[model samples]
Target: MKKIRIQCALLTALSFLMGLSQFIIVGILNNLSNSFHTSIDHVGVLVTLFAIVYAIMTPIINLSVGHAPLYKVLIILFSIFAIGNMLTAVANNFNILLLSRLLTALASGPSMSIAITLAAAITPPQKRSWIVSWVFSGFSIASVFGVPIGTWISDNLNWRFLFWIIFILSIILIAILYRLLPHNLRQKKGHGFLRQLAIFKNTHIILGILIPIFNFSAVYIVYTYLKPLLINKLGFSTNNVITILFLYGLCGLISNQISGHINNRKWTKTLVSFLSVQAGSLFILFLTSNFKWLSLIAILFMALTMSVQNSPVELYYMEIAEQKYPQSLVLASSFDSIFSNVGVAIGSAAGGYTVNTLGLGYLGLIGGIFSVLAISVLLILNKVYFQ
Candidate 1:
């Protein structure tokens, strides 16, 4: 019990740093743009490229390295992540920064998926879902704590300094994880990476993956542009905008734990309900764009519900995969991570396009449309898969 607790805590802290590193760029986009002498939209493309690389690399690494010992693989991959951050910190041009992002993305996708696998492996079967939640809540914690700090640092210091911080944190975590985890942790040798692809033959499995894709797309379509919405649309000072983001992140932290604690029997219903609420919140966000106070409440609601839905959806998918296609968890996790990156990649890109063409105010309606689609998929999953 003590061993598992220490493992979860260290893994959670590592994931927190992962989340922090990924999101710091969003908070410091203005700094990057100014530093690179580029447009904000152009800087936004960095996110798209990073996600695309992550999506591309996740499966490749999983396929090739899934058979390797967990602790050793993680240490090696984490080292790559640290190196990538160092590269970014030293980058003098946009192209170099872009390349550095690709490097980090490549290592990041596999590292995260493996971390999830490690978390599941180290715990009791029934407690696995909660462990996953606790591990991933590190991401929410990044939003709650790290983003605000990074934003403040960017406002006061050089943007490159943020990557330097990520570099140091990554290196430090490697040591911490080494101390906490056993060496050479290994999984049941599944048939192979190619066999993992068979898990998708089941429509339910495929839809399970798609649920989060659409869900993330829905939230990120607007969220990717949140700073602009708060600053330009709602007439918030930068510091005030950060404050609202802090509130939003706080709500997200609350939601992350909420999903993990919900009764397992309620997983599907909770998922469907949250998707519905997300759709409604997004619609209200669109309609109430002109109403500042209403929009603020809407943001909080969206962030809270948006985050709460994620763990349930992911837990459900992993549980189903574990039961139905037990040996293909590596593959399932790989695909999950791939689609997650693809979802955010697509969402951020679409959001960028919407900002350019349709304007940020319409982002909510567009997001709501996707939210409805996700809900529709979940309803079908419940009917076809669960029932």
Candidate 2:
């Protein structure tokens, strides 16, 4: 009825907010560093810390809170997110800001996975992918609009106001969610946390976890340091950099939607093809950085390939989990989040080290290597599992 429709809208909105919180940092990095009287390198730690907390806390939170009533947990987590965003807005020092970022990240762990689970719970199995895709589209939209708008705000107004905006959005989402979502959507009896954890023993589950790590390590190696590459290597102005990012986001949005449709037809081959193109795109980017237009085109290609790869990998994990214990699918999603965030942390650290020790030009080279390695892993997995 109207209730279900409202629930879906609220959940999708919350997903968008979660994604905006995660990526808005990228757009405001310069402003934050200047405000805190720190270097951009130091501000980079906020990204690392947020990824690390999300990696560590996702499974722990899922296990502890999975059996709770979904609506109650959603409200509590959204409220915590609001508090975190508000704290970040008012923080006067770097330490306080870092702490606030971690707090916001903690809320993110449960919010996304729980939202996915709720969507799945409401939708029929046959239409689950469509529903999940609609919800997850929030992430693509965040990268497209949220990051650019945040950057504009930080440039035109105060950076703190960006967090204030997020806080207001979180508060609004809390109300919508409370009104829309079912109050008592909990299993009467379920497998205990320990039992759910046991599902990790499956080989497919372990492979699924590692695939995200490998793929995202490649992604973050380039993306985390992209701004500097555009400025220092390509000699682009600030305005150009933001505009190019907006284009990259637009390409990514289209590619993600296309990939979702492709997944229904040829999941394994689509993954392999996208990863291969991604590796090739990174290589081209590294080699072509001196050419402004060519480098921008390379970025577009990278975004397209990476977006095409995302949904298939996510769908692959969900499909594999379906053959096993269905309830543990939520844990599988949690593992996906953990490994992907861990990859972000690893890739960012590696890229940072390479940039400091070697040079910025080496970032795309390292990223290409990681992408190739990920492809190799997937090829092996495909042969073993699909064959």
Candidate 3:
């Protein structure tokens, strides 16, 4: 029991590092723009490129290596990830930085998918959802710790310094993981590409995967421009925005755990309820932006509802795979990470349009619409599968 607990904790830490690698750029975009002697928009392209590559490459890599020993695959992926961060730390020009982010995205997507599968493989069936929640909490915890700290590092020292830190941490984690993970760990070998493609034919799986797209689209619509939202619309100082982000992240982390604790049978209802509340929160944020305290309350409340659906969604994928599509279990694990990036890309782009056309205050209104769309999808999935 203790050994399994330690293993789960290590996987959670790996999730934290991977999440940090992916999101750290958000907080330090300004510093990156300055360091590369470019506009913030150019630097912003790195985010889009990363997400596109991540979403495109994740399933491909997972399918290619689905039969390989999990232990070796993990090490190779993490080593590549570490190398990507090192390149990011050392690159002198925009092109090199762009290439480095692409490399990191290539590794990050499959790495996280395998990590979730490994967490599930090593735990009891009953505890799978709980452990999956812990793994995901790593990402929320990154928001809690990683993004703010990266922002501070960028403000105080150099932006590249943060990448260097991540690079060093990645190396140490690789060694620790090698020692802890079992040599023979592996999943059921996947079907051929054409065979595995059949998982998408099921309407339940199709709708199940779409949940994250609308869910995260709603989030990043507002979240992609959170700093301006807090400062310009809500009358917060630059420094206070950082503090508010930390609080928001803390609430998100709390929400992840709270979602994990809900009974599995209740997941369908809980997910719909959470998304509904998220819509309400964003709508409230839209209406209350002029009132400082009320807007702040709405912001935190939205954060509280943000990550509550993650574990349940992940659990749904795994359960569906185990029950009906055992051959595609590894492939199943990659969907959330893949589609969630799709959501981020969609949301960020839409948020940009909203900012340009409707103004930043309208971001909350747009996000609320996506949240309702997510709720509608969840309800449809419930009717199709759970009903």
Give residue 192's lDDT in candidate 2 (0 to 100). 82
Please identify which of the two predictions, 1 or 3, would achieve the higher lDDT against the true structure: 3
Model 1 residue runs over 4 Å out of place are none
Show the colliding residue pairs in model 2. none
Error of 1 at 384 (Å): 0.8
Query: RMSD per prediction, one decimal?
Result: 1.5, 1.9, 1.5
lDDT of 2 by residue, 50-79 (tens): 999999888787777746797888789889
Off by over 4 Å in 2: 1-6, 187-191
Per-candidate clashes, comma-separated: 0, 0, 0
Top lDDT prediction, candidate number: 3
lDDT, candidate 3, 1-387, per-residue tens: 798899889889888988888888777766787888986556666777788898999998987875788878988998999999999999999999999999999999899999998899999988988899899899999999888888888888888888898899999999999999877878776668867767888788889888899988898888877766776678887678678878888998999998788656757788888888899998998897788888788878888888887888888887888888887888899889899988888887788778778888888899999999999998887777876
User: TM-scores across all candidates?
Assistant: 0.96, 0.94, 0.96
Instruction: Answer with 2 or 3, whichever has the higher lDDT.
Output: 3
